[model samples]
Target chain A: MSDPGTITDSGSSGEAPVTMLATPIRLDYQYTAGLSQSRFLQGIAQGKFIGQRCPACHKVYVPPRGSCPTDGVATTDPVELSNSGTVTTYCVVNVPFQGQSIEIPYICAQILLDGANIAFMGLIQELPATDVRMGMRVEAVWLPKDQWGLTMASVKYFRPNGEPDADYETFKEYL
Target chain B: MADSEVLRAPHVLEYPYVRSVGPVIGAFLTGLRDGRILGAQSRDAQGKATVIVPPTEYDPVTSADVGALVEVGQSGVVTTWSWAPEPKKDQPLDRPFAWVLVRLDGATTAMLHVVDAGSLDAMSSGMRVTARWRPAAERVGRVQDIECFVPEAANP
Candidate 1:
């Protein structure tokens, strides 16, 4: 009934206590057949982007998928993508969440990796956290040659390519 | 692609969680199912007297071994509390409420539970309250069985 935030035990004398509630959250996930994310993940480990071409629809998918969204059928040949891409939309993560890396105030952006129809999710690096922007031409930062794995995180973050930033209209559709 | 129909779908689901409580808590629950309150003796260097339901495996402050579980009285004293003007989902009460940490008789630390008193003024630290158990037919192996606490007559 009284003020909810009032400290009733005002005279409490002891080490400041931090109440950690074990909040329980349950999640069950199911996967659908498309481009095998695992194989694409393997490609990223080797410092490459793989995409699949739908034989029926002729659309090229990035991170080579198992099937095409438009044709509703499995893709045949897998294609490797170029590392260069233009920045689309992005946010500067000034706030940190539990179990996060790279500290706070990092740039997470949508990158339209070259030779792919869809943009990929990645981080932007090298540039000051304040200098990131849309339409900036950025390139991938690969991991050490020996430490690559089957994960996109191998690319680390993209840094400014030092080229003229693309106009907003050029990369607007990628967002 | 313009004429393509978008069939949206959800991606995640849920499952039941089964918790395995240790011996002390196991015996305490056995007592509750048969209508009883339980507590454990603190075995820390301080050797403080503390009562805990679902008898804890170790002391709250120190990890010292607590004594065997024993039945304690159903009454308690409120310690600290917070009021929820608008209760959240799955809380004990559907209406406004006060979440109080009640130090049950013989317990050193407190346990959180809802207080069904009329208003804030009607509730205070050191107020005496008693357990209100769920209906006999609905009792399950869970904390909800204890329901909330209500004001009780002064200690005899």
Candidate 2:
């Protein structure tokens, strides 16, 4: 085959030479968390887990949102959620990326919290990577209260609780 | 609730890519690096000569290749402005300033930049303003090389 670079140069005869410049454009923004999410974060800071329930469908949502995705109605009911949950699915992370805080070969799992309809992702720790299973029971291992603030970072990571693996029937719909 | 505190968080958006400025825009940025401003020479629909700042490779109205590069005056007239009471992050100025559209002395079209007038009452259309270049060491081949614009009298 002819050289790949020469095939793309057919239009260069009439055009002027071009030069590329590199520049870094940095922008920062402050986002205001609205009513529903603000309440959830405040609860996390106080070592309490809060979720909102959809008024029509009654689906409990952790990390509460203003409106329900399923019924498209306002989620006005606030519900307290247990810190313990079942690991519905997980992935073994071996690849590296910029701004990644965790070490390689860690398990990132989707946790279906008790009393909530939706699942959220978090780092799974305090267990061997190979031992992490699809139906493992886990609980939020929180950081010291002095280190807590308005962030979910207060929960360092989720660890496997001594409870037995949740039955497949319990989290089948969540997958 | 009015009494409830609003929660805030920081977000950063970044584009990690390298771009080619092409011949016309490359020339303009090079001029900025050397402490000068260049405009593109073009013809309007009426075939009259015009110059545009932050030069474009093709004329915006006529869609024809710009004819030549011309050096333009540093001072200009503020054609319009809006007050930014609380400047957002990464804007040209950190303090309260005016976002202005200025028509340089020799250019027909306007360019956008911030003016560091102390207060909103100090800014108005038809005000004379001059480009304020960043220090020589901080000069990069980019539009931001000119840190901001200041009132002509304030610069002197």
Best by lDDT: 2
What would the per-residue lDDT of candidate 1 be over residues B1-156, giving only the tens digit for each residue?
121221222466544445665456555554454456667766545664665554677776677777655566777888887878887777898877789888787766677788877677778888888888887556544566688887775323
lDDT per residue for candidate 1 within A38-157, as digits (tens), equals 556657778888787788977677765678877798876777888788889888999877559797788888888777777877888887888888889988889897878755657777
Decoy 1 TM-score against native: 0.47
- Docking level of model 2: acceptable
Q: Best-fitting candidate, measured by DockQ?
A: 2
Q: What is the Å distance of residue A158 in model 2 from its true position?
A: 1.8
* Tens digits of lDDT, candidate 2, A1-175: 1121221133222232335677666668898888888988988999878999998889999888789998999897899999899999999998999879888889999999999998999899999899999899999999999888789899999999999999999999999
User: Least accurate stretch of 10 residues (summed lDDT) in model 1 chain B?
Assistant: B1-10
Q: Candidate 1 regions off by >4 Å?
A: A1-35, B1-156
